[model samples]
Target: MKKILLITILSLLFFSCENLDDGIKNSNSPNQFSQNFGQSVQRDFMGQVVDENNNPIESAIVKIGSNHVNTDSNGVFILYNVNVFEKFAYVSVEKMGYLLGSRSLVPTNGINKIKIMLIEKAPITTVNSGQTSEVNLPNGSKINFDGAFEDENGNSYSGSVSVFAYHLETSNSNISELMPGMLFAEAQDGSAKVLQTFGMLNVELAGASGEKLQIAEGHTAEISMKIDNTQLATASSTIPLWHFDEENGYWKEEGEATRQGDYYIGNVSHFSWWNVDAYQSMTTLNVTVVDGENNPIPNLGVTLTDQSGFISSTLTTNQNGNVSGLIPTNNSLTLEISGAFNYQEQIGSFNSNSSITIVISSASVNTFNFSGNVLDCDNNDFSNGYAVIAINNYVDYAPLVNGTFTSSYATYQDTFNYSVYGVNFGNNEFSTIVTGQADINVSNTVSINDLVVCLNSNTINLAGDFNLVVTRDDGNIYTFPNEIIQLVSPNNYKTTTTGSWAAGTIAQDQGYNFSINNLNGIIVPNQGLCQGYYSNNIYGENYNGTSSNGLIINNNEFYIQYTITFNTGPRIYTCHYIRN
Candidate 1:
């Protein structure tokens, strides 16, 4: 971890005293549709924070990458044109008196909406380090401390250790909205893996002065959770214990838990979001979101329901209007998308990499199309940018290509009271917003001007499908109908973090996504910044198999491809990827 992350008492106090509506707010608005390839692709996310009782939790600090926004009074926050990499996006939220919460999703090209539920962080009781104590949660989960405690510095500490604990039931319908991240786990071997949860626990300790504490060097804490009856039917005698890495958003396998009767008992030497989950074989699913007429839809909510009834957090479509993520192989799953109408379909037992299209009808909703141009501060065509039209608290983000942009929106607003904003990724610059009122289903021309598209060198966001063609030594060719990839760029002036590909999986192997390090821009002379990588011999699969060297982008009028050559023991394969 390059940065030190902390949840400070000072921040809690500051938030408790600050106004709730001081920052970002959101309202449900129709998604704006636009096709943006390579550098011009944009990703947006909107979601709400709530409590166990389904009440909105407002003013929470929500963050994705360097962009952070406070939830509005309605517990809604929308981040337009956010920075997200790989196939997944990690979002963390914090409030004054709640357990830190986070949700991870595979963001689509345009609008990705999700929901998060935060548990309250109140110490049930204080235990003295000099005496052993055991506490049981209301849900039959139990925790035991053996009279040993230490500060984070490893020194013997200790008067009273305040313990904050919660048991996460796998059977809860809303568990998807409350879980930290997807079932992905970072195994001890550093391989990418997925998980099926038996149960989970959130444990945290605070010193006498509210500072963080941990278990003593030679001590361990025991946790026992009652496995849900449904999960118990298929639960094994032993399960691997994993802890959440909040900073990286992947579960880290550590210890193991043994089943005893109806409970799973585990011991941990440290505290974090610990879980009892077993690795599951997974394949990738490329989801296309569209209306009944086949018009690509954006910001539509799609929820996954597993065979065991374990529902997944809802994900939204991006500007390119699609969703992509991992799904358990040979497992029955159902996708449910809600609008004026509810569309539910079961993707029968899926065993390999594939794609699914969900057609949601919006025939009764008011749909409108708007066209405009995104210009520089001097009112010239601004390429590599996005135009925004916000009404009430809802926003529409349209890609600006060579200064021109077009979008379609579905809104129920009586009259359009909208505002426009733009950004040029070529450089870290923003435009002055244009505000006005318009009629529904009426043609409107919008010009979002006065922004600097500076002549600078930097990385750019990558989205859409990359056509993959692989030819093995045996002359056997494997073709992936489409290879969807995401690379969130580093906004030159705002962040120092270099961009990298987020993990994802495909058909062949267990899980195919790799953690390719340091994605720096490779600027081709006379050509725009399209793709990049700074290291070689990365592990796992970039397209199909492992790459012995880092990727180099080849851009042309027809298609942009990355020719990767690598090996697996005695087998060598050459893979060429073009924008599909």
Candidate 2:
């Protein structure tokens, strides 16, 4: 039956737009209609429309993009021929006595089931004169409208009146239906009681239609109402008088009501819904800060700011991890809680009258010492200098005046090392070599183990044929011949070779190979060293399998030491080459 109804509606709709310029192409037959839209692969989008209470809402309009469908008695709707590959469809719903709802639906790849909930509109309550009516508000409170009144020569009398009260179902900048701490109170008769009651009066006596009263220009009428014992008991005390501003849809503060024993008396100058509330009452809130394990965290800074943009307060938790404050009733506030030293900060919103507990997590701290010493090539302290350790891109430096320096910093817990380079400014006489290793692990404990580095230099003057003799730790000796060792001058600053030569030697005694005046310089091995192995340079760059070496000249002797570890133990290899 629904299918027939849909086809009929579609046919009628198509015919109605036949003459329009942008009308869809008209189909003369049912087969043509099917061919126009039924050729594509079809998928069914099934869903049910439910009210806020999960009850099915029948006759609601469900629209998917340009397509429209109406829910059946069960509030179930199915859209046929929906393209499954479309990925997303914009769905909107409309129903009488309910707020319009919308949701974006993503096809479940295989499943097309969806559930959409709609909020029902609050019933519009209207009360007539000289009678009392009880209507339940959407927020679970019940309001009783008692008798109406008219002032006849300053005497109160029962009169005809029209009163309208509606709970604004939709929220806007002007009015919000949900107020914090607003709830149904128990009455003396075991029924749900209202926070307040209202009694409206006729503003005028003449020129008014039935049940309606007209007020004179430049003048207004007042509503006289009584407070029942149930309301007073629910409030637990006296409350201020207020009127619901029908024009503005908000509660406005009027003068305080005079509590005459059991009844409170107040005056209203205009016609609208009147209410008695304790908005001015002080509401207390208790805040507690705790860790993830429920342990109390004391001395944490907590701040509360009313979302209404008026009030703010700051306090610190006591030893019990609790802090209490009083706020104006029915307010929502944003709470921010923070602490020092390894505690994470948190911020959220809460009702001002409610007690809440906030959780703070503990953060792990990492501490390590970055220490090393700056020295000369002769193993002497290079006083007054600085050294830096570069871990990835971050750099940390410490001053080394007496050849030793130490500094510490904290980082997150991680397993990593640093690449360090040290330079000593010997009063601008020379600079320490930029040399360091990349294997210092500082993940768990304090580290201050130092690596010795040579920084001093000497001048070289002799370059000639040199015989190299190697000695192992076991006193085994090996010799290599036909090796060319070059000693370059200071003016030839660019050298790319390794092996020891002569330093600080005058050309008059040693003969001129490279000129030098007591300045230590580097050695260059112009040919390959031992088959195909080239020495590693100062920079940490690898070329094939060739490794470079560093040399320091001291005590008029050449000291070259290298370690080769094979499986179990390290074999120290030393080489001594002489030019005479």
lDDT of each: 0.58, 0.40
lDDT of 1: 0.58
CA deviation > 4 Å runs, candidate 1: 1-94, 103-117, 171-177, 306-311, 318-321, 360-580
Predicted candidate 1 versus true structure: per-residue lDDT over 1-580, tens digit per residue: 0000110011000001011122112222111000110122347776768777554554579999889987643356667788665344678999867898897655554446567888878898888888889988888888999988888788988798899998888767666667786566566665545576777899898889998899899899999988887666667899899999888666778989999998999999988899988766556666787666776765555667677655554555544456565566676877887543367898857787677777666454344556666655465788665665665545554555567666655544435766665655333344544667766555433344454444342223233234566565578776654343322222211001111321111212111222223243222111111122222222322333323222535221011113222233333345555654
Best by lDDT: 1
Q: Which ranges of candidate 2 are over 4 A from the true structure?
A: 1-239, 246-249, 278-580
